[model samples]
Target: MSTRRYILDTNVLLQDPLAIYAFDENEVVIPAVVLEEVDSKKRNMDEIGRNARYVARLIDELREEGKLHLGVKLTNGGTFRVELNHRSFGKMKEHFLERTNDNRILAVALNMRIEEEEKQSGITVTLVSKDALLRVKADALGIHVEDFLSDRVVQYDRMYTGYKELSSESKQIDELFENKKLLIKDSPISNSYPNQFFILKDEVNPSRSALGMTSKDGNYLESFVSSEEPIWGIRARNVQQRMAFELLTRDDIPLVTLAGKAGTGKTLLSLAAGLYQTEDLQKYKKLLVARPVVPVGKDIGYLPGEKEEKLRPWMQPIFDNLEYLFNTKKPGELEQILAGMGSIQVEALTYIRGRSIPEQFIIIDEAQNLTKHEVKTILTRVGEGSKIVLMGDPKQIDHPYLDEYTNGLTYVTERLKHLSETGHVKLQKGERSGLAQMAADLL
Candidate 1:
């Protein structure tokens, strides 16, 4: 087999700082321009900045082993090098005239490709980048390119939906309802996961069905008991929502993940469950809601306000759901109510680090924008007694380096699907409104 060389782009390192060690036994090359880009972003306060600083520290540590310009031996038996000589425009000047960092990175890959071919080394040189446009340009330049795939948990279409439809006999459905728990051995379910929901349809008559969830031990199919009344003035309009409600209200499950498109009531359902548990059930001491401050389009830059005021714009979507839940009529009424209650708190995910959150119903909205590392950080902070609900639409990710398959929400859903303490649901229908559903479906 021929040895393969992977030239990583700056965005790849920013997306995953440990990307250099991901390719097993493959020569990893980093263009000097990528280091310059990382240096420029090292001062950022967000995740990207943290990654930039991490990458710098990693390279500095590797520098002690050997000269980076020549090559350094990686722990995985792979060679790592920082190419400093490929500064010429070379072939890229004929195509892209711009002298951008992307182009400079492309130039390094193109030069390597030429050198490999000329030497008849039988080695493959590929550019590993997360930027789609940069990948296209590399392809146009006759250089092989691929997206970083180590972080991806599963394909988007094959992502776990947290539930399954199994054909069962009417007797089994009746047994589940009568006893409130049917042993899986006697049922049609040959395989199951902890906390997995099921819609068991009768093989003879599909209309005869029952809703059940797998026990924590996966030994029995337990009946799903849904709330008969409204929760914080919110009712389950669909089966998925009902499933979400069941998971949200469960005191045994410590982690819940909900994935769906906009208008699917992911945020509203989570908020309603949090409020109900905090205020009505008194199961949790407080209800804390937070979301990443990722902008859809261009950022408005700095805003003039205090901490709470600065976070209002990013947390407005959460407030919108709170308003509906509280049924606040007049302006600023919801704020007053929240202040009077003192149990509900809304904040940004930025300050959630370094704090131990206990006895709280924590709802993380737009969780798809979070990276796996960030999600881990958040989950680790869930002190002794707390439930964290992470809800987001995988398709609507705003993170530049994240896709439906690689986002933190999907990562957790697939990785922890078999765990007893975690529960997940992928809401299929949008209960927001007809227009909202239509737009979510069409747009």
Candidate 2:
């Protein structure tokens, strides 16, 4: 195939500035507007802003090797150049080029398509973006548009719910649960994870069975261990969320994994259960909450204030959930409550290495942004009396190299789901506002 030229939208650059490297040695184009957009966001300190700055530095490094407009060779041996040419289309009205940034990005994609159409060398110029509306507009213009499916849900539905049900003979169910490792011969559950949970029932009677899961080797299935205590005032509204809560609170289950889409309440429910168990029940001495420092909406560092003030932006989501759970109508009540407990702690996972934490309830949110090594480092820090809950919507990840299946969250789910002491749940319901749920479903 001739060289494929990929034009990155501003969102793409902001999300994973190094994303240009994913196209192999193909020619990559950064639209001039995308640079302007990224430059504007580079001053911020959140993940997106950090990514923009990183990409800017990367481009600078490349410029030192060659001309920026003439195309510079990347570390991967691929060539990339910035595109500044802009032409109004006959089919598009001037309104399309107004003050909005999304439209300009779309226009650039259309222009690239026009120039590529003249080549006829099988040289494809595709618009890479995360905005659904932009993709729709590009499609209407006969220009190739894609939603940077870089988040990588190969079979979006393949996202599993760490739990399954297997109907077996009543005698088989008893034997499997009673034994340490009841190896089965080609059982259908052979494709499951180590700590995953399963409900084994009689073939004739749906209710006559036991809850179990397969081993890491995909052989035996066993029961699940719920978090230290059943979280009162916290229960799953849906079957998946229920399963998620059950896994999140398990004490025997040292590593609990959760996957879901936005508004599924994965993060909220996990925090609620962690708080209930750690603060109320004293299942663990302290509750340690940490995330991968991946920013979702805008950057945080650019906003003024100290670390605590800077953290409010990142900690806002956590505070939102805390506010809801505590039924606090006033502002700052959640922080005060968490502070009063002295048992609840919120921190970033950046400096957790070499620090052994025992007797703690560790909740890692936005785990999708974590690398395999990073997750392993955090998981290994768990000491006795400590249970760790890792939750994130793999589809909405912020990391660059990590994808849906290959991410650390999925890696742990794949590696530990078979253990009887570990479990996983994928939240599918979005209990948030109707618009949020609709956007999650449609987009």
Candidate 3:
């Protein structure tokens, strides 16, 4: 078999700084233009900037092995080269333009393909990029292309739903309800994971049903502790919501992840549970809420105000939920209430670093916009008696480099789904309103 060459784009490196090592034994090529773009992004104050710095450092260390311009051998038995030649502009058509960095990178791949053809080497030169437009352009220019697939955990369709439904006999359902616990070891259901929820239905009498969550031992199925009680006047409207409430109200499960579409009550339910645990039960000293400050549409220019005023627009939805829970009507009444309580705090995800929070109920909303590393940092900040809830809709990710499968919320859920101290529930039904549910389903 002939060797294959992979030309990586700038976005691929910024998305995964160690992407060069993921090509197996294939030869890796880094276009000089990609280096320029990455260098320009090193000063950014976001995750992309951090990844850019890491890539730069990695390349610099690789320089110690030998000159990068000339090829250096990687540990994986592949040659790595920094391509400095961009003289293949005549190979591409007119519409691609010659001055852009993307075109320059394309020129490098075109040159490699031309060289392979001239030498009769029978080598395949493919462009690996994360930009869909760049991949299309490469295909138009007759260059083979692929997206960076190293970071994608699973396809959206095959993602874990955190629950399952099983049909059983009426007697079995009654046993689960009466005894409150049943062993599922010899049951036909296979591969039952820990912390997974289930909806058991009676096959003989389809009307009889019960909800159960698998024990940490993955042996017994236990009924929910409390699903009938309301949290801060918010009752569980559906079975999924009741399951989520069971996990949220538990003191033993320190981490909980809720995922669903818009209008599924992910945020509202999490906030209600946090408030109840902190204010009513006195389980924690403070209720802290924070979310990533990702922009949906065009970002308004910097506003002039203090911390609360600057955060007002971004935190408005949270304040709205709090107002609904408190049933406050007058303007500024919610603020006055929060101030008098002196236990609730709302801040941005940017200000949460370098702080140790103990005895607090922390809610990180819109967490699907965070990176895996950012999520790890947030989870590590959980001090002695703190409980952190991560809730987000994977389909509504706003981060430029994240998708449904690669977001931090999905990453955390997949990694910690089987842990004894963690619980997860994927809400299926949207209970906001008829119109909202229709829009969420259709739009």
RMSD of each: 2.3, 6.1, 2.1
Q: Against the true structure, candidate 2 has what lDDT?
A: 0.73
lDDT of 1: 0.88
Write one digit per residue (lDDT tens) for candidate 2, span 67-126. Answer: 788888777778888877754444456436464677777677776677667766777878
lDDT of 1 by residue, 157-196 (tens): 7889989998988888999989999898654563778889
Which lDDT values do the candidates have, in the order given?
A: 0.88, 0.73, 0.87
Q: How do the residues 1-443 of candidate 3 rate in per-residue lDDT, one tens digit apiece?
A: 32899999999898899999998888899999899999998988678889999999999989998999887888887878899875578776575765688888888888788889889998999999988898998898788999998898776587778889899888778888899987888775436767788898889877878889888887788887686798899999999999899989988899999999988888889889999999999999999999777652123347887778988888888888899999999999999999999999998887886689999999999989888888998999999999999999998878887888888999999887768899889999999999999999988
**Of 1 and 3, which scores higher on lDDT?**
1
TM-score of each: 0.94, 0.70, 0.95
- For model 2, give the 10-residue run with minimal summed lDDT: 292-301
